[model samples]
Each structure stands twice: as structure tokens, then as C-alpha cells.
Target: MKKSLVLLFIIITHQAYSQSVAKYSNEFMNIGVDAAAFGMGNAVVANINDVNSGYWNPAGLIGLEDKQMALMHSSYFANIALYDYAAFAMPIDDRSAWGISLIRFGVDDILNTTQLIDSQGNIDFNRISLFSTADYGITFSYARKLPVQGLNYGINAKVIRRIIGDFASSWGFGFDLGIQFKHKDWKFGLMARDITTTFNTWSIDEDLFSAVSDQIPTQDLPETTEITIPKLQFGVARSFTFSYDYTLTAEVDLNMRFAETNDIISTSFASITPAVGLQFAYTDLVFLRAGVGNFQNENNFGSESLTFQPNIGIGFKYKGIQVDYALTDIGDQSAAVYSNVFSLKIDWSLFR
Candidate 1:
């Protein structure tokens, strides 16, 4: 049964590989990073100020006080897939900051059963082998405070890499732009992902592909070029201080995609999904966070119903090192079950 399922997956994946202007291409990049952000429903664009900013809204990097680094890991699909992220950032002078980040999502140790049945129609378990599929994203980011005291802007140059065992591979590139403004306790942010459409060119190993070709004689070679469109994220946040020892921050964000989908708000020209997050801190050392996002309309038979994902997290900071953990997809609104995400952030100043 498992071998049959694997064969089906390979066939479907190959069929979908002939892509042009594909929607949800390079989707692994959208899964997000940092347990703190995950706990906050990924709504930190306006007030982010750490190494992780390289993945959210680079403009937020301007708030970094010193050199920093971060790492995060999460598992999905009942531990069948793994997601990992790492980042580094440092301030340049008083008004600029630069960062680099990497993300990897992969499913490993899959039984390649394309040859499970021998040419003579005999079943041979030894013909099975193992392979893996993975996607990676690396980003270089820079942020600078504008002359307008409260404004800042950032840019990202991204490189995307993907591989499917020894069968295929691809490389892609893209850019992102972000801006942020702060006034009193209010913060606003905008992030244009793939500001210019991203492109990925694929290369298939014909030698290994011959096996698949033999199975599907009618299948043609997959297309080489794949395109990803742009998406926009807007955020607003406010901080409230309750006494000298306690504080709370609330943020709301909207993700706009150019194509219509099952998001809460959809139209022919665009679709909008909203998310909200909240964080409470005590003297900036301990934190509690929560957020809800991924609002979608589900169809049951001929009826429609609303569903959303809820995430919660906690954090601890000592000196300049912070650790965070989050429980996401609490209600399993999506296909994947709940996942535990953990992240670590280090401030170089702590060691200095």
C-alpha cells in the first residue's frame, strides 16, 4: 500500500512540475520562521527588531541594538517533514542593519518504489530504494532608517533551491521590499514579497527519469520554467505599558494575494486573509503570546463554514539570550496536525 502511494505521489508531482505562472509556487517560504512569530500568528512585521526580521519584514531590522543570531525548528505531517531556519543580523552604524537568513523544509527517507515490480511482473522488495525531497531559501537583507525620523525601509535578495533526490533540481531568484513607520505607540508596516515575480528553472536527470518514462509512456518531459507572483502584507501594531513592570503589544495584519481563493475575503482580482496577535511581557524577561490566522471558508457538502488556526507560545529571556516555544494548528483547521515549534535567539552584546 505504501509503495503504491509513493508511486502515485511521484506521478502527480511530475505532472505538476510543468509549470508556468504557478500559484503557490515555492510555498515552503511562506511557512514562516521563529517560534515567537508563530506564537503571534506571524503578525510581527510592524514591530519586529531582531535577526528573524530578515524573513518577516526586513525593515524591522533597523531596531536591532546589536549583533544577533536565531535558529528555529519544527516538524510536520506526523514527523514526516522537517522545517529549520537560521539567521544572523548586525547593526551598521546608527541607522542601518543587515541580515542573512536560510530556511529548509524537507521530507526524507521515502521508499522509492518505482521498480517494486520487476519487468517480469514479479514483486521484489529489494528493488525499492530511499530518496528525499527538499526546498531551501536563502535571503540577504538590508534595512536603513530614512531621514524621516520615524520611517525605515528594507530590501531582500532571495535565492531559492529545490531538489528531489537524484531525479530533479531547480534554482530560483527574487526580491522583496518592505517599509515601516513608527509614531508614539503605533507602528505600521508593509511588505511586498516577490516584488518582482520570482522564476525557477528546473533540471531533470534524464538517466534516472528513464524509469518513470518507462511507466508512463505518454508523459512528456516537464517544462523547465516556473513563475511565482507577488503578494503584499500590511501590519499595524500598538504597545501598551501597564506600570513600569508590565507591557502588552497587539498587532493585526492582512495578507493580500493577487488571485482569488478560499481566504476570508476573495475576489477575482485579489484575496485577503487577516491575522491578529498579542504578547504580554513582564519586565521584558518573560512572555506569553497568542494569535489566530489562516482564516478560510470551508465547504461541507453545499454549505460553507469559517475556520481559523490558533497558536500559543511562551518565552524566556535572560541577559540577551531568548528561548521560545509555540503550539500551532491547535484545532487542525488545515490538513496537517498540530506541530511544536521551538526557536532560539542570541544577542552578541550578552557575551560582549
Candidate 2:
């Protein structure tokens, strides 16, 4: 049965590969949802556990004990943008688990300068309009342990919505699949994201663009479609025990975007995106994480040095409750610098 399922997935992916991916349809979905995961440079594919696994790698959810719930919130890019996430997970019988989660990213009160000056030729600050852009998604996730002991597989179904004030909006749907294999202190993982080629059919009218075209050229525009290319993530992790009181886990993940073979780079596979993360824990009470990733090294120091992605996080777990905090880079330190992420988790054992 697993073989058949795998074959079906391959066929569907092959069919969707012909379509081109667009920009910003469900882009918020790419932001790391968990503080611990983000602190590790978004390298949780093989090192995931807890409720946030619903977004990182649902396959990791099967390992969760009892029922769990988590909540997270953060502000990005100097507080101009905000992100929030929540999830719940519980085991089903002995071999499977189910999870549900939601994510929201928004930028509020953006100034619209279309009507900066009034007809009377006097500058009017009131004429400046404020609007918002928001992207939201709800996900249903399931994970099951394979008959082969240490192997697990999972899937996620997502419903997404994007809004830009009252001017434009879009609705989209997508799916993700993941697998994990663990051997002693080592683990491996793979994730197929947007497997069916997530696409958003935008609803836009000329009225929204006609005004801006007056300054440039009044060219006709057609309907627009936003497509999200399928992405594959490969990860591996190893745990090292320094002593009975302390343990450290190191992990790395590689991201390959299948649709980019034909894009602006022209070369097949283009460049690889590598993420590395480390976690230090004392028994099961406290955890510290540091990571760096998402670096597109163009080999030019001047331009490449400008790209920065780093994170640090700490967590505390006691009596089935966990609290985590992370600080991640947002932009250049000169302008808007960093973002803070906080999350809380409650395990069923505490309630029992």
C-alpha cells in the first residue's frame, strides 16, 4: 500500500511540474512557525518534535506523547509586519497522530499615496489612505508510523487566503508530504511541499492599475495567476551525548526547488540552500539553540555580506509545560533589525 501511495504522489508531481510558480500567493507559509525551529535556522525537518511539527514535518508528530497544544506570535521587519501561529496535536490509537494548525502574517496600516494631494492644490495629509495586506492559512495534518518500526510518514492539507484591503484578494489550496527515518541517535527526513502545485487565481480589475499606468504606459493587462513551485527538503540530524546531564543535537537541511530549473538562473538546480542548527539541552529541563541558514552566496562580498539570517532561542520545560523564546534577524541592523518569537506548550500529562 505504501508503494502505491508513493507512486501516485510521483505521478501527480510530474503532471504539476509543467506549471510555473508565481510570487506571494502563499509566501507567508515559508516563514518558520516555531521559535525552536526558527532559532535553528529553519532546519527542523529531521529534528522536529512537539505540536509545531504540524508545519515543519508532520511525520515528526507521530512521536509526540499524549495531547499537545502550542501558540506563537512575533513581529517582523521593525514591527511593520506581524506573524502568529497555533497548533494542536494528539495521538490516534497506537500508530498514528493528527494535528490542526493555523498561521497568519499581515502588514497593517500601509499608507496609500494615490491621492496624496487634494483637487484644491493644497497638500492634504488626510488624503493619504491606510490599508492592510494579510495572508492566512489553516492546515489539517496526519502522521502514521510505518510497519517498519523507525519509519514514519505524514501529510498536510492547507486552505489559504490572501487579501489586500478591498482592492484585490485570492484563495488557494495546497498539500505537503513528509517522511522520517530514525536509527539510534541519527535521523533523516524528506519533505515534498506544495506537491500539487499550489496556485491562486487572482481577482483583479483594471480600475486598480489604470491609475498607475497613466504615469508609465497604458498597456492592457490580463488576469493573473500565482503559482507556488514545489520544494523538496532533505535533512539529517545526529545527537551527541556529552554527559548524563547534557546532550547536544546538530542538524542540517538542504532545499531544492524543482521549478527553478527554467527560471532566471537558466542553469539546472541553480544554487543550493543550506541550513545548519544546533541545540544544547540540560537533561529535559532547559534548551538552547543557535542556527544560520538561507544564505544565497553569490560569492560577492559586497552583496553577499548584506544577506544575513541568524537566530538564537531558549526554552524551558517542566511538568509537561514548555515555554520557548527566539530572536531572529529581520533586516539590516541599520534600519529594522530583529524579530522576537514566543511560544507556549501544554502537554496532556499535566492535565491528567
Candidate 3:
């Protein structure tokens, strides 16, 4: 029975063991951090300026006035999976800034049923074990103001680690580039992720893998190497102030992938997803945000329909400490699993 289960798992992951460029490789890293960004439909690429920017648009780190830190936790699939993130950033002189961030997404305490039956063909209740499958990402970022006025640029070096309950593990590396420009109340930004093509090399435990091969006489095993292609995000934003106390900001973003997808705009060469976000503020203390994104064409049976994900959030800020909450969807509206996201950000300047 244990061998049978292992065979099933191997069959399900057969394609994953091949050397290829997967469209959804390293997907957890793209989930985005910070409830504020989630509440704003991830459209703040143009105007973001905080510790969280290390994941969104590193160039925005240049906006940090002092040391800053942020943390976030969210659960998905009804709490079966947990996602956590933490980041720190500080200004470097007046022309440059640097930041570091860590992210983890995992399903914990999974029962390892492969050992449920003992070698003596007897049921061994104590043979069962617990393990976890998790993915971790660490990013180092640096940003500097360009010689040209109102322009800033940033770069990121990323290391990725993945583990599967001692069954398999992998290591990967990648790079990202970002640029942000501000002119008056208008902002523009561009982000290029996996610019050099991230690659993951998987090292499978042969002792564990052989257990499956022993069950099947004609099975071959091979090492796996996965690749992630480049993706680009472009954004524009503007802020409006009224009555000396009221403010509103609006932003638009375009996400472009290299291959055809279910996005609203698709071609053989590329696909584009558009997102729009709005924020209303009172003296920059209290805030309300709403946005919609993840446009896709869902096909039910033989019919197709358009759907999107909508998000709403609120925030409170006092003396450089901010708390934000967002109600967002893990997937698009077509098959949505709503999740509540909360995040906290602190400006160390207040303590200094």
C-alpha cells in the first residue's frame, strides 16, 4: 500500500521532473506581500515607497526616509497553507537605499503515509510521520536615484529554496530590475522579473526514489531542472488633493507575460492583464482602498465568460506605525477563495 501511494505521487509529478520552462514556476514569490498592496489591487508599482517595496518595485526603496520594517501573514485554502513575509529597509545616504526581505509559503504537518505499513506486512500505527513542503525566498535589493531628476532605479538578487519532506529539494537563483520616475503628481514605474531567467536544480533522494522504482520494474528516473521566464509590469499613477484635508490616488498597471494565457488581452506572443486601483485618504492618516485585477476568460463547458478579482481594504496610521487589512481573492472571481490579509509596518525613525 505504501509503494502504491508513492507510485501515485510519482505519476502526478512526472512532468515536474523534466527539464523545461514552466509557466507557473516559483509562483509563491509572485503572490505579493503587504496588505496595502493587496488592497490596492497590486497597482502601487508606480508610487510605492516603503520596506515592502523590496518585493513590488525595488526602485521605490529610494523613497524611504529612514529605517523601516514590515511583516505580513496570510492563510489560504482554508488555513491548510500559510504564507508569511518580513522585510527591512533603510536609506543609504541621500542617493541610494538598500533592503532585504524573506518570504515563506508552506503546508505544515502533512502526514507521511508512505510508512504507514511496516515491512512485516503489519499495520504499525507509530510508523506514520509528519513532514512539510515549503518554499522560501530571500531577496537582497539596492536602489539609487538616477542622475536625471525624478528618476530612480533598483536591482534585486534572489535565492530560492524548496523542500518536500526529505523526498526532494532544490536551489534556485534569479535577478530583477525596476525603475520608478516621478514628475509633479504623476508617477511611472516598470519592473522586470527573472530578467536572466531563473533556474532551479532539483536533487532527489535516491534512497527514497528507489522505493518507487522497486515497485515498478520499468521506470526510469532523472534529475530535474526548471526554468522561469521573464515577466514585466508597467504602471502609471496620479494623486489628487482637495480641500486641504482630502486626497485621492489612482493607479493603473499592465502585467505582461511571454506566452499566451487566459488574460483579457492575449496573443500568440504575449498576454496582458490590466489592473486598476483607487485610494481615498484623510490627512494621510485614515485610508480606504479598492481595486480590481486578474482579468481572465473562464470557460465553463463550451461557453466562455469574463471574470476578475476585486479587493477592498482599510488602513490606520499613527506616528509612523501603520496597520492595514484587506479582503482579497486567492484566485479570480470565476473560482475565488477569499482570504483576509493583515500587515503591519513600522518606521524606526520614531523610535530614534
Q: Highest TM-score, which number?
A: 1
Better of 1 and 2 by lDDT: 1
Residue 56, candidate 3: C-alpha displacement in angstroms: 0.5
Cα RMSD (angstroms) for every candidate in the order listed: 2.1, 9.8, 2.5
Among the numbered candidates, top lDDT falls to: 1
Relative to the unseen true structure, what is the C-alpha lDDT of residue 151 in candidate 3, on a scale of 0 to 100? 99
The models' CA-based lDDT, in order, is 0.89, 0.76, 0.87
- Model 1 per-residue lDDT tens digits across residues 120-180: 9898999888888889999999999999979999999999998888877899999999999
Question: Model 1 segments beyond 4 Å from truth?
Answer: 1-8, 11-20, 117-124, 217-222, 334-336
Tell me the TM-score of each prediction against the true structure: 0.94, 0.82, 0.93
- Model 2 over residues 232-305: C-alpha lDDT tens digits? 88999999988688999999998777533312232464435778899999998999999877664343545533
Ranking of all candidate structures by their TM-score, best first = 1, 3, 2
Q: Which regions of candidate 2 deviate over 4 angstroms?
A: 1-25, 113-129, 205-223, 259-266, 299-308, 330-337
Return whichever of 1 and 2 wins on TM-score: 1
